[model samples]
Target: MSKPYFDPDFDNLLERINGPTCRVCIDNESMEDCTVVKVDSVNKQGLLLEVVQVLTELNLTISKSYISSDAGWFMDVFHVKDEHGNKLTDQKLINYIQQGIGTTRETPSSAKAKTYTNKVFRPERNGYTTIEMSGTDRPGLFSEISAALAYLHCNIVEAHAWSHNDRLACVAYITDQSADTPIDDPGRLADIEEHLTMVLRATTAPSTSGNQANQQEVKTAGFLQGSEDQGTMTNVERRLHQLMLSVRDFDGPSGPPNLPAVTPTGSEESDEEGRRTVVMIESCDEKGYSIVSIDCRDRPRLMFDTVCTLTDMQYVIFHASISSGGGYAFQEYFIRHLDGRALSTESEKERVIKCLEAAIERRVCEGVRVELCADNRAGLLSDITRVLRENGLTVVRADVATQGEKAVNALYVKDISGNEVDMEFVESMKREMGPIVLHVRNETNGRSSLPPRSSRFSLGDMLKSQIDRFNSLTAL
Candidate 1:
């Protein structure tokens, strides 16, 4: 965990700023057969998603919601109920919900910290490098893993992760971003392994030792402080920063607001009619990968959805540049098959384009919706869809996106028996899917109960077993 670049005073300012706070007050009167949960908190990125996750795990159906954010504060009111279409009376459950969404304040540290183990190992693989880790689960675990990968310059192509009973396992297929190949240098691979091991160990380790606890607290405080700073930035400033990072010539017509001469990178593609998105793939022999360029009208989670689809389909992204301007996003990804071959046939290219297009379109549709955010693991999409299918939920549309270690999935569905999604069905689905999402979220957030001995296994084999167990547990 390298300290984020920031002014010396920034940490002090963050310490003074209040983080998010949550309160769950059960509505006793007014709304019949419903409980209203009101949340007032300082706004941060992904706040809504986190709230939804907590409610879903509690088996509460949100029949209606009023959400608003102003300046830096957010107030959300959710009309919720149990499966029997009755108001909730469980004080225990209400307490659990409050605890789940409660904010933890960060205190800045006076001393610098060492963050890595610096040990690395090279696993034997031909085209891809496999990194697998298992440990006691904790909050912010996935974010730490993602940071480690980014620090090592490793590009994740595919991933499968799961957490069960306070234990977590993650497997990722990666390639060196600069070289577009499996990490071959023993020294570099050693460093990658060492750093990630340290991150996982630190998160999993108990804080009984006062010295270690202090160190961990300081590290987390710094990380949260950086998050606070980013959350305070205006949308325009954030977008402008993204634009500057993606475009080489800031003077072009496509530059940020008021820079009329800076030309936008995807303006030509935007000129076309009717198509909200354009996907182009071309072979790059020298690089041994295909170049994928996507120009589209930007919307929420566009990049995450695109990357999720690619990873799910087993395509490997070596290098990528993602930028948004005005109202559109321009993206370029250097990709290859898992077997290290370029996409060759027209059919293959069309399939790739169609998948990306469909994923983008799904994000804009509405139906009987369920939202999930968790640590991204390999075969996670399969497991989620399997649960829905088993519960007779017919999926009409689906959207999956990942930011850092968190995968957010939205599914639009209907009952297979041609009935509207009633309370019974919603409860059933929640009961089945709640633990899966909660476990991943908890593990990624660096919170866990205890590690199970059976949790240790290879990534592929472990995924299969875990899915099988879930099926057995949720089998109708």
Candidate 2:
């Protein structure tokens, strides 16, 4: 086989080998009604989500938490309680958690085979190149697409993606980095499409080479074997030292950096006008990264949306803090462009804030109506409708039709409360629904589902109630 594509700088192999390991200890002597769970682990991508997922699966509710990460190591302490608000005394459960987090798993390669369609490229009114892609969804699909764009040195200004039933669609506003202009050249546009298509079609499986595996094992053992330098500093101290070195590099001006001026928006301060989501972006001189702070009401999938938006825009998060209490979430992220520079213009900063604001607004608003066509199956309609309900959506009208094995579904839906569905919600629905359609199509030998027909209806009281609550919150 051809040598696998490898970039030491990009892959950060050493970092992966030394990825976070977890240790969980229960504090029996804590003076509280809840159990105290102490976790120490090496931090990596999706660390928070993993921890939260485990706790949630265990049916543990976190009453309070203290989370911090320095360099690659993180220490999190959570005050948790069982469903009855009692301290957890189950030894087996505690042991299960301890073992669950102690081992590291290899990160999966991004290359995967996916089907793409509705490929389109056009010039936006804002003098930016717009690229829209729709295709079958899989894990790491977004990363692969972003990687393709980065390879072409494209600067993404605005992006939105949605996935439903395993189908995914994304619309990105980007500009050519080298030219700093719209990608109007037909040749360049074709080249971009070709490269993106290749990425989408590529398939990669994990290496099975014993020798390569042994080499990785040896490297890991060496780290644990210890050295004289390891004796001089504790692990936490070493991590802090590494963090300091990284900060120094970030702060040092390697080029003529154009930094945005800092202006406080007073969004963080409390006012009698109720809770208003505040988004602020300012330059951090010490770290040479832009600190984006958001103070907003907490809700389901809030962090996912915010992080997704930033990731879609090609922002590299170096450090972040997320905390929520009293029905509000406070988040601060230290970030830089993928090229390691701060945003260069006022318009750029504004765009970043605007995107974040839009994300936040969409979380609370009614979503857009969606229409889907797929192969018919038993319980297919119920499955699709269930997904909508689970995602906090209310279907106001439905038109379902079945012609032979093919089915067409048109649903008018809004946020459980009646507000315009956000782009994020639309993309999420598409990602989820795409797979079901694909599976049904295959089972029927590529035949379409029978088209069944339904009728449209007026909004119900539940939707009205949601709208009232939303209005009340916004009024405050």
Candidate 3:
């Protein structure tokens, strides 16, 4: 087993000053398909997440990556490309990446991390109030919340909504409608909180059989936050992951009601469309490391999701390799607990596997992609969502943003029964919302576009080859 080169208990200024920091080098000619980015830095918990987060936030695609951290240093190489699958040729973007990825410091230890006293809303210095909520997944939920905010004269500047395992987590950035600034009045903030809380706790419409459980109000919670947990503030997407985990969204019922939830390898058949994400964990006893292997459909921001979960779970990734092709992603990680122990128990392994799966599937939005670009106005979000609800469409995920005078929103919607959206209804929606305002971006069949499992190349073989390469590096 390898060990850290630095002493954890050391306090000498020279030793600290001479310790390793971060260095980033980008190579555009390493390969024709992608740019190669290599980072050498001091090994610290959460460092990997920070690097991945930067790349993800920059909207770059990580086609492949190699990570190794032993002897107190992080050495990683990422093969990345732009959203259009082209090499990052922009010098400005490359420079920004070097600066962004090279400056991440170790997150403070838990004892030094900030603790929150107010669990409701905290006004950010940028003149916006951030509100967070998690609750049971149901149709029209976002509409209800937005309606309440509109009633309170709050304008949602930006918002992200994600649903997984029959649960929902949302982060909305809002400002006072008239003032165009953060709502500083405690009374007004309280009213906002109360109204949202009631909306979240409202019961779902009863089914034909009138099940009392479905009729009962869901147990939900909301909190206002100025920033994410731990020491440094993170992006809103990562904050959503933290919020969902805190609410135990991973432990809830799998998928939407009447939809098959993805499970482990032995029984993941429920999600026939995407073939559920597969996560496996086993101990590399000789190296005192726990190896996590995952195979799932390739999607944007996938690396960020998995790495974020591992960091939050306090797992230190010592080595990892990621590759994607043929519409699927395969990743392998050598990790140890923050306490420097391999995952030792069956329950622990199971929990990590489940959480990792949850992380990956959380953003795997199922439904049709509809994009709206129109002039921004009051009650716009509420009206759009209400129209969806009335048309028998349910939103699985949404991204709302306001840029200057335009409202650019993306909504992934499906039939209320968790089926593909009807093109006819979508057309009607376009006419009602204005044909030029709302457009049907894409219709997803809710299945992997790739061929069947038997027809595709073997994932096990791909994983084994990657593992072999990773092992060779570690051995050297």
Candidate 4:
């Protein structure tokens, strides 16, 4: 019989060629529209996600990808570009990508070098305290959080807040106003935690189901507590997803906005024009794999959201083909449980579909996009959110960041009654906050414009060749 595709000897041979460090090769001359990134490394359980995370965090758009890692070695190729659809020509960015996914050195056996975990190396230029909070989500909840932080004299430098199914997860980096450094006082830290916990409890209505108390958690940590030489950091967005999952955010009535119902037999469903999200699952009895297919509107970080969900759900992806074109995304995965079993029961299949649907929906912001840029201050968030609450708008999603002296923020807001936001209100707010500082970007009610029915691309035409190539490489 022919040797298996992932034979041990094949991996040994790769180790000798690539050395002990991960190999990242970039080809800019090959693809005109995108940069081709090739990675070869020893196979690890979570290595796929580690590589994807680096790209996603950089705000790069992955146009196409082929993933294969079943044994001792992993090799993959990705076609990527910036949001503007240009090739990556920045030398600094290219070098960072190399260092982010591979070691600083080609061979690590002899030289003493600073090793990178997950290719993360954060320098200690600024000191800040990291605050993580999760609890019941409510309208105007962010305003309250920011108000409290401002009251504590903390300068909010960066924050990300996500809400799904009446749950909220927030991570904020702040510095003490007095010292411009992380708060290291034990007593002060306890006070901050206690105050935030109380605010969370007060905002949440009494849960008739008696599960409300289980959703609250507050953590405060100093970024300077650890050794400065170690450059380890957590992917905050991934952590937010985990926190939302931990609170059972997927159990809500919202599965995606326009996705149709899916049955246990993996019946495929789409909108009348087939523009909405389409999900289907099929089990390969002979190969012992459960195949998942997803087709939906393409957006930034689309693959990261799905892959992270599958990984967190304890499913291992043996093979996957991902590609996007004409503002639509196509993804297929051959996966199995960590215990090496395919999805057997009907309930198991249904749950997988629902969880994947929920994962997709969590990142789909549904409202008017409002961007705020101003000088950073302790009360900037507090003031901005307060005005939003008072203007009959509710923030559905928010991203707050600080660059040098500027506080740049993006917020998605809808009318309190869930109607389309009045542009008059938006203009009024822009004037109130200074027209030069605030701007209206995009208004997406969880839907993008679909191509005309006659010109719609079919799944078979988009994915068949890629799938065939993957199968050919893995065939014994």
Candidate 5:
């Protein structure tokens, strides 16, 4: 869609800079003075402004921010002393900030590193063509390779990442936020791909050597969005980013197909036209769990594409959550509302599941795994902690898991010695804690709720407990 442009001057630094101190930093390092209050997707300058604008919008305060630019490579440094500066714990957020600017989630992923994947559209950005890059994960690889994108002003918007027990993959989406500049400049993408080749090179020994092991593939795809869809695009883009991260986080491609809720009764949607119908999945999170995994594979983009395909095929979406593999994914979509279209023919359901199954197959690793069971018992959490302590680990964040009359305690922790933990230890601890199951991990990346750093307890649970105590005192 063609978007009109306006060049607005960013003379209001005071408002953005009005936070508490002049010196702001992250991980204790001080940032140089850098404050921008506006963004222009048309001109390259506006891209910088958008970076600043997104940080500000997320309520992230960084004082004395410093930026380095050489050729087309760019590096931005800032400090965030608190969570509000970065609410959601997202790998994408970290990657976004590392490159330039991005949004923050209300829920934070408490980790030294976070990685996610997403899909985005820039209707008609000017000056800078939006560019993104992603591939297998490597240490310090991003810093060395992103210089190419920075040199060409490929402001990073989002990055998605995930690795199996042995392999890794990543994707980064960047849009030129410069006003008065085109959003699809060839120089931008070319610079990015060149640097991408450099960034993706393996300096270390190969792990997946044979046919699947010795090589790596990095491909790029792009599409311009429509103007009428801009309003929806923001939601779509943000969700896409979240979905990408969720997939990588969950390692969706490694999991099995989620059980289909609709059983085939040998009934065909009476439509002789043979149009495909969408899979209609409706169920509370899996039994014994509040959240389950979805095979996101291509991240939420796969989910989005599937949803779009269903819509085009005349299906309707009632509710959806692309974050989980919901490949173990969940959606209450069907063709019930189609214009007299018989939606759930036996073949249609089979075909829809097949389509999603294919999506999971191509994207999911044949290796990811997940397991769940009830966890509500006395001293369950304490036992979990005891086991962790015995295993030479420390609890980083533990949650109070209760269902009805039972209580189950869950924790997110890391090995203090950085030792590779045995699955048996985790399972044994769960058994001791009476969590109802031994272990649960996404089949692909082995990404589980236990490993990642989490801060979910910061939300109202404590306050609610305190309120409960006060009410009990009143009753006494």
Candidate 6:
């Protein structure tokens, strides 16, 4: 028996390694793209084990590799292709790789360089973005649209909504929620628009299904509202909207727009850049109501930076915006890009607003009650962390408060041992900080489900079956 092999930085293990020579070809090409890479190690088995991933990804025939006729010089040669136009052969493979890598310019076929360049932006300094929604009204228009947006997760910065003549038009700065969600896919946006239309129709004017109550909920749904009470969407509009959203190619058939080819400052592309989007934002609103005020040059940059950060951190973009002011305090004008994908779920969407509103409260008035009071000496973040650590709890995320000499910290903590530090620990940390405050908790962290789980098979049965198979095979 051979000693097992091991790769320090990767998953390859030496003990179970097999040689590169395969007498039979194993090909399964239903889904994953076929790409393969072969390796040469201390032995043929070790090298073959290392190349498993390359084999799966490249989808190559392993039996046809360049294997040494003599056992002394062990080598596994894969037929992988490189930009240098050389096949992975026994002799020139290493030299071919040297030419393939460490170059200043990348090749067109380099999947590593494929990019999805998206951006999530708040309102910008001088640019403008506008969203005009015109449709028949229905009950739950506002709530459904707002709720759908709440579901899709978006924020309204500067909005002017009204029912004019007989139609509804809604416009606002959508970049308020975080630039992680983009309204780029015409299909998705259209679906959302259709849903918005349905939501609006349902809210503005119910289809005789609603008398008045659900209809009222529709009116305040979002900005898009028609005075009529309607719900549910007609087939034609829904189909058309869905068709429009089927856009996948980021760069259109005409190629990138003829703007000066300059990368935006502070924008980061992925290692594999698969797609990219550009947006311009502009708007105005009540300064005190949100941090969304246009103070100077950096203000727009901050908004831009926030969007960029969202896109870079997640895959989303702020497509466009346009705005002017209304609210209160320091008058403002701004527009923002609403990146839809940023908030992964409807609940997350609510949290997005929750955070934004908190930011807005602080912006409107510095000393406004943002959250619960903090404990000082015991309440300090470090002390609380110490308590959590001492109790085998790992702090997931934390928010702290400070006023004059006193402080308070709220922590979201969990333990690797599957046991959580209780309210006692939280109170203890609070006491260590300064004044002891009551601890409120959500006990949902890491507690295993007590409810019966549904699975295809039980572990005990699975183990027995495996043992039976092994016994039968050994006897054979």
Top candidate when judged by TM-score against the true structure: 3
Q: CA lDDT of each candidate?
A: 0.50, 0.51, 0.72, 0.69, 0.35, 0.29
Every model's Cα RMSD, please? Answer: 22.2, 21.6, 13.8, 14.2, 22.6, 27.2
Candidate 3 segments exceeding 4 Å error: 1-20, 106-115, 205-234, 252-260, 264-266, 269-276, 431-436, 446-476
Question: Which residue pairs collide in model 4, if any?
Answer: none
Mind sharing the TM-score for model 4?
Answer: 0.77
Name the better of 1 and 6 by TM-score: 1
Which TM-score value belongs to model 6? 0.19
TM-score of each: 0.27, 0.39, 0.81, 0.77, 0.30, 0.19
Write model 1 residue lDDT over 125-214, tens digit each, in one string. Answer: 236565556543344454456557766777665444432222334545567867657776877776776687788667433334664233
- Model 3 CA lDDT for position 12: 44
Q: Write the per-residue lDDT of candidate 6 for residues 1-476, one digit (tens) a residue.
A: 99888755244344324533222122222214322333333332122222322232232222223433123323334333333333444334444333322120121211111122222222233122224343432222323344455455443322333321122334333422345333444454555555655555542222343432222221111211111211111111111111111211111111222111212321222212222222222222432111122211111112222222222223222121212122111212121223322233444433333222222211111010112243232212333344334444443323343455544444444442434334343333323322234354554423332333242223223323433554577589
Off by over 4 Å in 2: 1-21, 26-37, 43-67, 78-100, 103-105, 109-275, 304-319, 337-344, 358-476
Q: How far in Å is the alpha carbon of 171 misplaced in model 1?
A: 5.2
Q: Write model 3 residue lDDT over 350-461, tens digit each, in one string.
A: 8888888788878877667888876676666776776667666677788999889998989887777655565654554555443226667554644433222243333223
The top-ranked prediction according to lDDT is 3
Candidate 4 local lDDT, residue 202: 71
User: What tens digits encode model 5's per-residue C-alpha lDDT throughout 1-476?
Assistant: 98877543234345324522122223322223322222111112123223443454344543223343223322344333223333334556544553343222111211112222322224453222333333443333333333444455544343333332222334444545344234444554455556566656554543454543323444343333323222233323332332333233223222222211222222222122331223333333332111112332223234433433343334433222332221233333322333333433455554555444333333333221322234232222333344344445543222233345443333333444434334444444333423245454423244333442242222123323433554577589
Candidate 5: TM-score? 0.30
- Which sections of candidate 4 miss by over 4 Å? 1-21, 104-126, 203-207, 211-234, 253-275, 432-436, 445-476
* TM-score ranking from best candidate downward: 3, 4, 2, 5, 1, 6
Encode model 4's per-residue lDDT on 38-116: one tens digit a residue: 8878766667777887788778999899988776667889999976888898999999888878842222221111122
